[model samples]
Target: MFEKILIANRGEIACRIIRTAKQLGIATVAVYSDADANSQHVKQADEAIYIGESPASQSYLQMDRIIQAALDTGAQAIHPGYGFLSENDQFALACEKNNIVFIGPPVAAILAMGLKATSKALMEKAGVPLTPGYHGTNQDADFLKQQADGIGYPVLIKASAGGGGKGMRLVERGADFLGALSSCKNEAKSSFGNDEVLVERYVMNPRHIEVQVFGDSHGNYVHLFERDCSVQRRHQKVLEEAPAPQMAEAKLEVMRQAAIDAARAVNYVGAGTVEFIVEQDGTSYFMEMNTRLQVEHPVTEMITGQDLVEWQLRVAFGEPLPKLQHELHIHGHAIEARVYAEEPEKGYLPAIGKISYLHYPEQNQNVRVDSGIVDGDEITTYYDPMIAKLIVWGKNREAALVQMHHALGHFHVEGLGNNIAFLDRIIRCDSFKHARLDTNLIQREDEFLFKNIQKANAQLIISAAFTALLSLFKQNITANNPVWQAESLWRLNISNSYPIKFKLDDENILVNFSPVEHGFIAEYQGQNYQVSGTLIDQNSIHIEIDGKKDKLAFSQNETALTLFSNAQNFKFAYIRPDFNTDDSDSNDHNLKAPMPGVITKVLVSANDHVKKDDVLLTLEAMKIEYSIRAPQDGIIAAAYFQVGDQVKAGDELVEFQVLAEDVA
Candidate 1:
């Protein structure tokens, strides 16, 4: 094996590679952009090198820079961890030219399967079952539309060179074909620098299944069984599991053979995934091939008891297959949940902010966490917002899900939009627990998930009160004040009530309280309550209200506090008595940016009248497009920004003027 290998990616995957490399007694080097200077991956690697700017094009995708860095650091090989330059055929060829081993498939394999159209044709020729679609090279819009028309409505417009659902659209009618095509093309061009698309018949109620295949230079090949990635949102997987539930052994064998054939067809080596779209009836059709390690590979690892990264390195070094196809067998069931820093209530708009507190479930033999972040890390708009991946294992699917639900309860985050609560709900939902999964899991379970942000429940309100009182008590102790030492201060009277107002979402709660024997007597929402608290830390506390105890988490700013408990996050602002006396209405006409992002398009300009629900602007953050619409019919007084402008959260994008007659 080579002495040193440089990782050509950043974030969790890079860190993941580094971990395996270290166990193999191999030295690893990490390359980072300015944004990831202090990243956990950088700290974990044996040595680190500075790359280019934050944007991938200038840094992670800068093939020349990455190659030169590897060479300059005396590294013998480069591992392209999944995303950046992993599937770039040119990069593989470049590595071959430089005499540095590329720990991935060959250039020929990448080229053969790089584009969807070419890959589809090759798969068809290779006798792999394929979906009915148009994978032609004809780029004319009319020609594609005609193909879509012939294929029937509800066809899928997929970017020829897309993954992670970046450039995909489902058109349900001929009237929406052109618009869908336009949107798909734009997103494709922006994401992959390829606007070409393929039209295919959309599979209704489909489950995504992918087989893990590996190969060596000696022409030996084996399969690591399969993973079902059916639970998805926006065509991207949210959770994945190994040895798909309800999948028969006979069908799995057939798919495994087909996957091996697909790999042998391309002469693929190292780690790769052969994806299939399986109908409800168990008929599977080839979707596409991913030529590198998958994000959900941990589920396969936990079930198969195999280290895929180690396999990749061994094969890259010309080693034979570690185990024959017959020798590999699935063990316990495993599931992986991708925890992202994106909001669910706000249409999953990517949230960019400092992660004030970050903690994952405690790791054990059954539960594992693979992450690239720590507390105080910032979730910026320059990169994907995935915080970590939670993987759990059990003897059966039901037990695995039970473990997953328990693990999610321990997963915590603050000061950003996250999907932890959503994950929790999915794991515990009756449908999900029964394994009724598909690509529409989010849509099907939307009712029970993300229930209108979080209202100020009694638990949260009491937790907040405890936290505030604790601070005051600590301050008095530090100052040697005797006020808190007196039991009379515990009982609030006409002269002792200290009114504190807090804003929760759009509603406000006022509480007046004083110290009491064994607890505190607090009045909130026109009721008095007994509350007790134990300080866990400056940022965490255990509180009890009326005999109900809750271990809650909280963080505070100058005028606000964010409290998290029981899978819910409540934002509260400390309404100071001196700050603002204005009970006037807020500026509802101004459409503010929900998060920090660049304005991709400004649909309306100054004085443009817009109807309610009209698309006024669009924001692109964390590689997702969010449309900002007008809440009600209004006249635009002025446009605050134009296309390609960068804005922060709460920055108004448009100012509206309401005429008296129209308002009346």
Candidate 2:
């Protein structure tokens, strides 16, 4: 084993690699950009080095900086932790040239498997079943459209070098093929520095299952069963499980063998995943292969009792396979939910803000949290918004589902948009419980998953009132205010009514309360209730409302107070008596950026006419592209920012002059 190794990545995966390296008595060095200077990975590693600025192009993807950092730190090996440079064949070859061990597949294997077009052709030659589509090197738009026409409608245009759901578009009609192809190519070029693409027949009602395959320098190989990653949103996985439920032993064995064969075809070494798109009838077709560790590898680790990172290290050190195929066995069922800082209701738009408060379920043998963030960390737009992964294990699939539901209920966040409630709903929904999963599960279960936002009920209202009261009381006592005492002496043994106001998602709420012996009596909307609670800690309270007692969790920030109850979070802003509302932009005839991002394309010029829903511009943030469209038939009065300009949320992008209703 190498004595010291540098993790050429940041965030959770980099921190994850550091953990395993330490257990093996190997020193770990961490490289960070400006954004991650205080990140958990940097704090955990034995040594840290600053590579460059915050953006990946300026830092993480700077191969020379990373390589030099590893050499300066005296690291004998470099672990590219699954993103940025993990699957780059050139990066792997660079490591080989530097004589530093790259803890991944060889350069030849990476080149052969890195591009989807190349891999599919190689798989076809190796006798691995492949999905019907075009995998040629032709980049002509008209040629690709003809191929899409040949394959029929509903074809998927995927970036040859894309992964993690980037640079992929599904066209349902021949007329939409050319436009979708252009968008896909642009995204591919922006994401992978490659405009090359492949068109494939999009499999309907498909379940994504991928097998874990490993190899060693000695030419030994083994299969680590499979993981089902069918529950997805926007073509990206949201939930994953190991020892895929509902798969027959015979079919699983066949898939496992096919995975090993795919590995041997490339002479693959280290950890890799062979993905397949399984139809409803159980026929599996090769989709693509990831040449590095997967984000959801924890589920496989939980089920198989294997440390895949350690395996990567061992194999990179030229060790033989840890266990033969026959020796490996799946233990219990495991599931993993990716907890991201995004809003499920708002098209899963990535959120960027400071994580004012963060709380997670307690971790133990059965429940695990792999994260690189602590309280007070910021979720910026520079990197992926995944906060942490919640992985749980149980004796069976049913039990694991139950555990996952419970764990999600306990997860909480504040100061940004999050999908904790959405994840909890997914685990509790009937379809997921019954394992009726597919790539379209999120869309299929839209009604249940994206239920209408609920207003504050009596329980939540009283909880908020009492929580605010107690919080103020604590502050008074802490500051040694003589007027406030624990005995209610401030009221002179007489109960006096007080008014508490709050703003709940733009709606104002007012509650009147009178101090009582044990708690408080409150009135709201002509209903009176008994409300009392004591602060359990900074973030929790034990309350009794109208004779019903419960303990709830909450987080209070400078601007808002959020209560976590019923598996959902309710945010309340303190509405002062003199608070004023801001409606300055209500009638403004301008389009604003919904989120902070860099402008990639300005499709409309000042004074240009555009129809409603016309593509006006495009913005890229967090590796995803969003098209800004015209809201009505209008003439563009002004286009504020040009391509490559950085804009914050609510920044005016274009001003428009709407046409009169009677205008011809």
Best by TM-score: 2
lDDT of 1 at 333: 97
Leading candidate by lDDT: 2
Model 1 off-target regions past 4 Å? 452-456, 475-501, 510-517, 520-533, 539-550, 556-561, 578-587, 602-616, 630-642, 655-664
Clashing pairs in 2: none
- Models 1 onward score TM values of 0.92, 0.96
lDDT of 2 by residue, 304-388 (tens): 8899999999999998988888888888899999999998898889999999888989999889999998889999999999999
Clashes of each: 2, 0
Q: Report the error of model 2 at residue 518, Å.
A: 3.7
